[model samples]
Target chain A: MTKKERPDNRKLDEIRPMKMKAGVIKRADGSAQVEFGLTKVVAAVYGPRQIHPRHQEDATKSVLRCRYNMLPFSVSDRKRQGYDRRSTELAKVITEALEPALFLEEFPKTAIDVDMEIVQADAGTRAAAINAASLAIADAGIPMRDLVTSVAAGRANKELLLDMTKEEEDAEDAVDVPMAMMPRTGKITLLQMDGIVTPQDTEKIICLAEVGCKKIYEAQKKALLEKYGS
Target chain B: MDKEKTIESKTLSAEPAKIVVPGDILKESMDILPGTGTFRENKNIISKVLGIARTDGRVISVTPLSGVYIPQRRDYIIGEISGINFSNWSVDISGPYEANLPISEVNGYIERDADLSRYYAVGDIIFAKVNDISKTKYITLSMKDPKARKLTGGFITELTPSKVPRLIGKAGSMITLIKERTNSFISVGQNGRVWIKGEDDNVALQAIEMIEKYSHTQGLTDKISDMLDKALGKPKEKE
Candidate 1:
């Protein structure tokens, strides 16, 4: 008989242990550090300052730029030192996810930059980076319609899961769906899939991800409010 | 000190002032209007930044706790010359955009090729007015106002731009008290730079730092005045 217990003994709908703190970087306009189980990530936001490379300047609104990098020692197998294809792709998607929440038109001809650095990796580094990025920008005081919350959900051993660990992700039939949304409006801003799943499984996985994101959204707001003292 | 304001509107009774983050619903009413750092969506007014949310009767506004200085028209501020070109000089007022001061904005006429740096070299400070801000971030500053002039000798200190209003107090009450006690000629810029030209400005600087640090707390004005009195060695008056 296939085992019914989860890898970490967490409920099927439960995520990892999450902790978030905003304004951790002294020099950044805004910064945040978030941990999901053993995965730790820090994000720093700068600007609405001047945008370099005059050609990149948009006359009507501020440009939003994002960079996502994983530390060489984050994974058991040391990551390659520079921007490979995967980091570049994640950065593009992460920027698109955050852009819709911000009112970039307010600061024309400028650029708001978000740097996400992953110090440790478990299973859902991309989602953690997105959460950290959203908090950092809000901490930087950039006006935004809402904070975006993200999480990964998947199916392993024919059972759906809210957040999968590396062990579960390695399951032979596992399918991962990383998603993000604006918790206030329930509007999905990011959705990506790896491995095949039934259409019904896709819908169920998304619903599971939403539940995870809602809890994370509350954590993001609490982190920001705590910065103001009580 | 609350990072707030109540202009002509009266106080709102429904929700007391509280810290809020982006997307927090401040009010839910069709009659309520969103103002500065707030927006209206589907009969709900939402906050757009991390700040203290306040309601002045039918309007809700949020005063953001921190942000880069965005120049406004007619705001007199202290700026340092960062770059000079043939036609105009670029001034950094600690904002994302640079303000260009054309030679015509100043009082005298000068030859075009007469070396622009002679009049205002890089690193000189001036108290000028923001004359215009274009949609494309082109800023124009004018020094033609009688109150505007070059500020020499005084050193510049920085404060968070959002805290500038608190440092100035209600109709100059807080700043004036500090100036009188320190015997300093203090010029506070809306852009967050304070210029102190006095024999002893240590007391003034300390008081400004306190305001920056403790701007969120209640009853800060009286507390600062007491600190200033103590620093100036003035006898305490108890009534």
Candidate 2:
């Protein structure tokens, strides 16, 4: 089957222009605004303090809670507020990705909450949220093992694009691979690859994700330093 | 001070150093490793090196070779109440879920029989401690703690919650600038509420307005710092 062509004839491993701003929220302990092309996300961090209900306490580590949401107007189609099943799943994935990178043991009996809102969703909203969340934590001054940089690599037609846009993602015969990693340690925090791929293809996608993540990491550091100098 | 001097010297270096590999120490004293670059194979796996650290030795720290978020404790945050329960308020802490602030943790002391509604109505802005959390996802808050309470008597300016860190700057520099300029006691809450108490309400209001206007722009810290300095008739220091 002939595959639909993508705009901007570029290499499969290329990413869109990325921009990040840290400490975008004046009141948040930590906050960041990140844009991967037109996909924009705002993330904020709060806590490392008490857990409510006096029940969810862990004697050895802090509970990492994350909320991932898309605003009503973020997409071309308006989304409703509150917990949608997709957001719930995204939240869990985000929390899992962040858990390994955070020094949760440092704040025992406490919880660190991360909230991410998609202001604009062009594509790769989940990955963008992961990137934004990491910056927000740093801006909030939360102790972490490392930053969790995430990127989505997908097979469009036979080509693996480093970061996929909504159009590219929705195209037929597309396989999505969203992965997050501790950029410093080169460890995988969250890895989700849907669709069919040979082991070779999977390895190639992971490598593509790593490249995208590194570019993202540079933007993140630049944003952080702009807000919190060296 | 020495570290700062070294960084300045490196920035001014005439020779553009060749790309350094991961684990290569950039400086002897700091032992900081240069960041890694990216590589791709078979149009599939594209890998990039993030950074390296000496975990086995005395120097034990992890720095990002790539980019990602890191959360620290005792970092002040500003948030908003997204959901409310009978005994707790769920706040959007800026990730995926809400953080809870319980009635027991309300900032001010309430008589045992007094209605919590009277003090902390839903949407009312307040600051409290992130006291604890449970395995079942219960977040505990404490307003009675000295550091937690309702922010009052100041002008509140709102911004996208993500922009809060820039407003605070590194090491409270931005906030300190606002405080010095307006001569106001300013308390920033994680909930997007700012409390500014100035000798003159006008001055506090002006400062808050300025912050709101330029919160998202570049060079805001420097701009606000300069504006504040001028407003206070303080001479700007040569950086």
Candidate 3:
């Protein structure tokens, strides 16, 4: 059977090239950089330290604060320098995706702050950002129940792809499904759909994403262990 | 059949010391008890985060090799005074939570609002004990003991809190060697803060950097001693 070829010469089920590195920043308690195809993100973890504005402190669990930003020069056009609507929404979802994996109760009344800056952006920037942030948190030595891994799967031209790029994402009738998972338990932590997709396609997309996330999880684990010389 | 084989081929490498990430199932057995860095669910023992799987007497755990310091009870720590309120001083013990040294927790009776800044003004470094940690994450500190006092005339630096135990070494052997060779007084806090003083301060600091840099390397003790000897120019005396 002849496999349908994507513009990038990848198979329909193939994801783009990816890389993840931990402990990239000396000053941050923990930091990681991740690259998925053309998208690149650097995430730094700071604090378990004191939570300011005393009232915001949670007595039962550590608060997770995430800030997702894009550099002005990251894309074709110069992006704005501060938080925009898209960035805010991305930050909220990213935080929610990571919150469940942490053992926040271990560090009550403190906050684990994650700052993710996208230096490059394709269509799946959010997935790359979450991937980088999880590595940064682990690098920070924060206790977590598991590392969260993410990937974007989509359907284009009546075909399902494991990971979609900016071009594939912009195509009309394209369906993008970004999903994050805890690989060991195979639990989905984050799922969002853009564009219309059939229920069967959604199921296929989710399964493909889970498989892709498992691969990403291996990269994350390798980067973390490399930092410790293990 | 091909897809089924592919899924089966994705099984984790079970070799001991192999790195495991969160959600990776370490085992599936009720005989093994989950320990730190691990959790059990659905009859499977899985790692909660990044670490190496370790088993001792049917108890399984993952020992994290990196990350920040999470404060615990009875940990001796060094902290810098950040703020002073009516009754307690906020201390930065290098963790997520700031420790509070209540005036009452000090060795001497502090007069209420009687120029208490003289006792522990903002920016003073204190060697204290984790007296108690409330559920709200309020860390209460105590300086009533002899070693617990205001530290003065020392250079302070930091390391990953997880590496602090390695720096201290078995039975404090690493610290003892550093002290004897450098002839400097040093105090290591559980929060990853270290204070160094005396004539061999430079030598001591070099040794510490070596330890922090090669923390995961083997023969750390010998490496540290060699680094110290080179820095201090002290010939090794035969034991």
- Using TM-score, give the best candidate's number: 1
lDDT of 3 by residue, B72-128 (tens): 787889999999888889998876667898888888677655887889888899989
Q: In what order do the candidates fall by lDDT, top score first?
A: 1, 3, 2
Tell me which of candidates 1 and 3 scores higher on lDDT: 1
The TM-scores, chain A only, for the candidates as listed are 0.97, 0.93, 0.97
- Taken in order, the candidates have interface RMSDs of 0.8, 11.1, 2.2
Query: What is each predicted model's overall lDDT from 0 to 1?
Result: 0.88, 0.64, 0.83
For model 1, residues B177-221, the per-residue Cα lDDT tens digits are 888878899998888999998955988999999987777666778
Per-candidate Cα RMSD to the true structure, in Å, reads 3.0, 10.8, 7.2
lDDT of 2 at A175: 90
Clashing pairs in 3: A48-B96, A49-B96, A50-B96, A140-B67, A141-B67, A145-B48, A146-B22, A146-B48, A147-B22, A184-B23
Model 2 regions lying over 4 Å from their true place: A1-5, A228-230, B1-239
lDDT of 2 by residue, B1-239 (tens): 12323332332222322222222223343343322122222222111222222232222222222222122233344455666666667765443235677776665565765665676666665666556655544555556666666665455555433234445665566678677666677776543446667774465556556765554344566777666666667755769
Scanning candidate 1 chain B in windows of ten residues, the lowest lDDT window is: B4-13
TM-score of each: 0.93, 0.55, 0.90
Please give the TM-score of chain B in predicted model 1.
Answer: 0.90
Residues A1-230, model 3: lDDT tens digits: 12989989998878789888998998887899999889999999997777888799887888999999999999999997999999999999999999988889887787889999999998899999999999999877677778899999988877889889888877878999999988866889999998898788799889889889989888888888787676
Q: Give lDDT: candidate 2, residue A179.
A: 89
